[model samples]
Target: MVDADQTFVIVGGGLAGAKAAETLRAEGFTGRVILICDERDHPYERPPLSKGYLLGKEERDSVFVHEPAWYTQAEIELHLGQVVVSIDRYAKSVRLGDGTLIEYDKLLLATGAEPRRLDVPGTDLAGVHHLRRLAHAERLRGVLTSLGRDNGHLVIAGAGWIGLEVAAAAREYGAEVTVVEPLPTPLHSVLGPELGQLFADLHREHGVRFHFGRKLTEILGQDGVVLAARTDDGEEHPAHAVLAAIGAAPRTALAEAAGLTIADRAHGAGIAVDASLRTSDPDIHAAGDVASTLHPLLGFPIRVEHWANALNGGPAAARAMLGQEVTYDRVPYFFSDQYDMGMEYSGWAPPGTYDEVVIRGDVGKRQFIAFWLAEGRVLAGMNVNVWDVTEPIQKLIRSRAQVGPEALSDPSVPLESLAG
Candidate 1:
């Protein structure tokens, strides 16, 4: 291993790569640090693109984590718009698209993920879109800004966060929105059937059409603009725009090419990583959506693509690179804003391990929180507008305190009291 102050090369410039660079400085390592981002622009917050940014409430600049000057001032090289084509792990160097190479003592493979595209026919149509990058958001924004209310229909292929949020936004813009999800419930994999049903109700109440347990057979379009969607059931729904947010896959091509261990942790499928966020090769560290590591609360290796991981995993990976034996363990926290409602979930549900569930507040009243219970303790939690309570629950979960199911289901009990 090289000295602690040696060069660090990060492959992705999203949340993980950006925060890792920031944390390196905080840890007092002032050596040559380089961040290689494929995007042309500086690292910006992606959460807002579906919510505040789409609602016209936030400026693009306002969402940037750090201005370009921060990297320059900190003496960290920011190589924007550069794609790292391959990594020579044996040589401890990374080669870029331009055939230039940069060597590093320790590397961070924060290559993030790529948006899954529609494989069906007519997917090449012009009016179709996917929301993953800044350019994508711009294209969708242009469509919403210039479209007809009666004739304009946005057909979303998935009911995940981006799909649902775009549905809300499209409706706000007076565009008819139809969400096509193969799953029986919108967020079934994450929120359970009950809560997922609530989400379906919330959107249905607002004129959004839901086609559950259905798959898009093909997108019929002309001249690069979407026309309608032909479903597996032989049903056709007219559409002016098609948004494919089926999910994302781990960008593991470069990692695999470099002889790094790659697994099934792509898109709906998860990857496998150790407790320290190290791939099969310890020299190459992974983070963000692309990584599959041991979940702190569940005590199991489960790969998740969450906002909290992108934010927290970087610091953990950095600590490991700095030789500070740290684990990427934390309650998996993620939130979504839908139709003026705040929905959040924390902790991890051990695979097929949610033996019981307890609830607080009123689910119908829209002020509820559900606690996932395994062996009568909180493993994960979901809340609807009960954020203040979510904080204490998060702490209790991190501390691994023994808060019983009785108190968890009672509304009179304060969340903090369960911490001890």
Candidate 2:
């Protein structure tokens, strides 16, 4: 049991950090709970930043995890806009950016990720943006609004979830958008080429242009403001603004500096943690994007950068800190929305891990549940424009049922009834 006088310090102010603080208090940890946040605003949900918040459909108040008043009432000390510079494992304390030191009996590192920037020339120019934080999204929203109504052209670099979602939102704003991807099909690695082609067709139907198998060579700007982009094929595409939504890198500098066991660089360079989310140092635990822990189902160390992972990792880390026996083995899940189509995927598998793709419903109509199977066992499943079926899909994966494609593709056979 933790001593009542102990202090618990949490770094990073994203959902993971906020949820960890909530878990600490909920589990009756009366000790000092200090949350160090680098962001000016209190912890908030990020999904809306790229969607509703950007479109002005959702208010700012709705995005925050908790009101400032809630933290005061809970007696949790929230040091906003403060950066944690270093962790002194020997001293059992952390040094702030301003050189203030704070001791802690336990610490949770939930430092999230930042958007990856394009290394091309003219990225420093104004109107070139990446969407990982609220500020970035807000700036992109303003540009989208101004350029959208004029039917301005918006050039998107990368065709991942964020890029596609932003493309959809830009189109909704009446902007002519073009997505540049270096792959034959977008999301080809994750959803496989077949499903990726389905999405490609979907976007094309909405008049969104795509330039596949092309690389961004440079961003053309005039007077420090973006105007267009050039591809490797020596073709210039006009653009009022450019959004590079490639991916995000985990914020693991503190963990690396603290001498925590960092996984191989190929494995995402995250803080290597055990099944309980405990890092090399027992008192330090890493969650969120910064953690690369053993995945029970995958039998490997996979670090996922999804909302659900952060949401679930927080509570699990807190419980483990209290010396409570626990295993952080929940199946990974994520969702995306674009152009009247919604998708929810459960479970994780490396690209090419599965040999067969089984589908139910109608792909031609853009409504279907597709499962990726390896050796007749369901490894992952995705429901597109299909509702109230994620539970059954998750159950199917967990059961590890050796189900045939015929039964899996049969709409008459319920997923829950499989494995029997």
Candidate 3:
């Protein structure tokens, strides 16, 4: 029942959109595939922007989802550097910035999120930066190197993953780094106070200064060049460069204009999609950071902005668009690399969701698996400097079986056996 004449339009050129196009072809969809991307560069993964690429460990080509010729060979009409200005759900078409109208039988919105801007004054200064795009990373890489050579100071506004990773990179480059976070500890929301302190300690040991319980109130600069950053506590930090690693907001203007249902702030505040990744309009689907999916297993609507979501969500959405039975309930997963330590966290356990945190292995050595439990049932797990345990950790979460905290903390206990 495949229709060769049918055209599927994908709006967004990030990993999700690119993977969706790849999935369409892999799934034997002979229909016309059109991918519209605002960025001139070919679709690429975003993680390297803050990780390997920023640290100069990865080449520019490594970030791209595919070779430039792959789209041509796959028969995917890739319109790069073209912006989709509007989505006309009624006409089943999208209007580009150049005023080109392209009709579609089904549409996918993979538009990712944009970095949240610092509303404080002097953010427009030359040394103030945000790390959301490849261009930003490219610029930041040189800036960090220059800062390091001159022993210039870097003031980071948040202690989130991006903030910490960039701090690590800056320290590795031999630059002075000071992170300002409003919360009591780094990654306060995700890891909570318990494990959040661990990251704070790790960064501190790497010579990164932390200004906890404070917020960057303003960036002080002269002649449009960042000189220093002022915290809410009235502490002034000399800053040759300032990085706003606060957070990102989903790009949902087109979806909202097209009358698609958007989730509320409490539910991630993104384009609302069912478990199938289908939006309010049956012909339209949303994925990646822009899609707030009502998860079946978690029993809540969640929008994840991690790299893993885009890596998997796009293909899932493509299969759903192909009229295949689909349910996107993959456990939320993310990882971070700082200094000499690398860690992977699986599942969702925001502050109140878990009653206790159990640790296996040694915390002092930074080699351990931390588990969040609620009523003796595993809610989430994080492995620090531990390898080959993500499978069992995910299984434990999926199993939803009650487990003893003592057994969870014991290194002798095999995680696979307890997963049941």
Candidate 4:
């Protein structure tokens, strides 16, 4: 149990930060708990910013982590619109933007990530936007409503999850949408070629156009407002607005400046932490996207940027901060919704490492359970247009059981019965 007089300070204001605060109080941490957030609003979840919230199907208040009164009731002090400028390890204190110093016995870094800005010429134009925060989504919502479905055309650069989901939302708003990707297919690096093609087909069926294998050279604008995008091949795509959804880079500057170990160049830049989520400094812990943790299962350090990691990692880090023994071994998981198709994937293996993809259901009909296997052992699995099977899929990966491809592809075989 934590000492009653000790204080804990949590930096960052995303889901991971909020969850860490909740865990501290629930796990009997009676010490002083302070949550520092740079945003004007309280901690909030970001998934809805691109999906339901952007489409206006969900209310604005629903996205916040908790009602304003929850913090007061829990006795958690909140520092809103305050940036942490420096960390004094020797003094065990943090300096805020306004020149205030907060002392802490233990510190948690949950600084999430920021959207990658396109460096092209016209990206700074008035009509071009990147959706990373609630305010960005709100602006995009206004742009969509004003443009309407038939009145505006949206050119989305990049075909990642954010780009595709935003494309779907734009289509629902009755706007003509076109997506451009440098790769041959969308999500090629993560889902591989065949599964990537399935998503490509799904978008095409919904009247969305694709410009695959092309590089965006410039964004054309008129009077400081975006009007079109020009590719490297001299092709011009006209647009009333542009969404630069290339990707996000983990927010690691604060951790880096604090003298924490960062992952190597190959693994990407993330605050390096152990299985217990403790950084190089024993008193400091990192979680969520900012942490590149040594996975007990994968045998390597990986930084997962999905919602599940923050939802689960926050609690694990909190427990570790209190000197409790814990290991974060959950498989990386993420899902996507585009048009009528919903897909869930669990486990992680780099794209080219898996030898074969075994399909248990029909792929032609767009409903199937696909497994990524290497040397007859299940490494990862995905269920597309299928439901109620994630638990079984995760079991297959965690158990590390070897099964023949014939058995994996056979519909007569039950996923639960196959492992034993």
Q: Best-fitting candidate, measured by TM-score?
A: 3
lDDT tens digits, residues 1-420, model 2? Answer: 335589999998989899999998899998999999998999988888877888778987888989889998888889988999999999999999999999999999999888888998988888788898877877888899998778899999998888888988998898999999998898876787868998899889888899999989999988987788999999999988999988888888898888988888667778888889999999999899889988877788888888898899988999998889978988889998887899999987657789888889999988999899999999998999999998888888888889989999999987889965
Off by over 4 Å in 1: 1-5, 148-151, 264-272, 399-404
Residue 368, model 1: Cα distance from true site in angstroms: 0.9
Indicate which candidate wins on lDDT: 3
Any idea what lDDT model 2 has? 0.88
> Could you report the Cα RMSD, in angstroms, for every candidate shown?
2.6, 1.6, 1.3, 1.5
Question: Candidate 1: minimum summed lDDT over ten consecutive residues — where?
Answer: 263-272
lDDT of 3 by residue, 249-352 (tens): 99999999999999999889999999999999999999999999999989999999999999999999999999999999999999989988999999999898
Cα deviation in Å at residue 216, candidate 4? 1.2
**Per-residue lDDT of candidate 1, residues 1-420 (tens digit):** 224458999989998889998988889786788999999989876788787887777887876879878988877889999999988878899999999999898899887778998999997788878888777887787787665346488889999888899988888888888999999988777767767788898899889999999999999987776789988999999888889999878887787777776665322233356778777777778888888786655665666677788899988888888888887677778889888789888887733667787888887878888888777777888888877666887887776677778888898998888878
Task: Report clashes for each candidate as comma-separated counts.
Answer: 6, 0, 0, 2
Q: If both were scored by lDDT, which would come out higher, candidate 1 or candidate 4?
A: 4
Clashing pairs in 2: none
Evaluate model 4: give its TM-score.
0.97
- TM-score attained by model 3: 0.99
Cα-based TM-score, every candidate: 0.94, 0.98, 0.99, 0.97
